[model samples]
Target: METNLTYEAAYKELTEIAQEIENESVSVDVLADKVKRASELIEFCQTKLRATETEVNKIIKQMENQ
Candidate 1:
């Protein structure tokens, strides 16, 4: 997993992977690999979202204080 992956990109990939899994388009041989990649993307997206939320909250608090 590259640290440079943007939240939107990771999210898009995750959605695509989920669709493939749901639609049974992924072959059984590569299912494990897809699952692993999806897990990584999910983690990346979650971390990015948490960081963004923290930053947004900090800015909001600062605005309120001022």
Candidate 2:
């Protein structure tokens, strides 16, 4: 996995992986790898969301204090 993966790219890959899993398109040999990748992507997305939420809250607090 690349360290520079953006949130959007990770999210897109996650969606594709989910579709593949749902449709049973992934072969048994590669199923584990796909699930692992999805887990990584999900973690990345969750971290990004948490960071964004924190920043937004800070900005709102500043605005309210003004």
Candidate 3:
């Protein structure tokens, strides 16, 4: 089973995309596609982050009950 992405990995990818977008050499048409993909990635990262937080909270609650 695959675990969710770690914060570092997600942040690194986001940073890379930003850097690529900043470079003037990218074409206009491709830029829109890139931006759309980046948006989706951002949403996925956010969802994963929230899920991780929820799981952590559940684990902590269970530990406290033990």
The candidate scoring highest on lDDT is 2
Per residue, candidate 3 scores C-alpha lDDT tens digits across 1-66 of: 126767677668777888988886668879887787778778878888899999999999999999
lDDT of 1 by residue, 1-66 (tens): 885888888999999999999999999999999999998998888888999999999999999999
- C-alpha TM-scores of all predictions: 0.94, 0.94, 0.76
Tens-place lDDT digits, model 2, residues 1-66? 688989999999999999999999999999999999999899999999999999999999999999
Candidate 1 — which residues are off by over 4 angstroms? Answer: none
Q: How many clashes (backbone atoms < 3 Å, residues ≥3 apart in a chain or on different chains) does model 3 have? A: 0
lDDT (Cα atoms) of all candidates against the true structure: 0.94, 0.97, 0.79
For residue 11, model 1's alpha carbon misses the true position, in angstroms, by 0.7
Q: Candidate 3: misplaced stretches above 4 Å?
A: 1-11
**Model 3 residue 26 lDDT?**
62
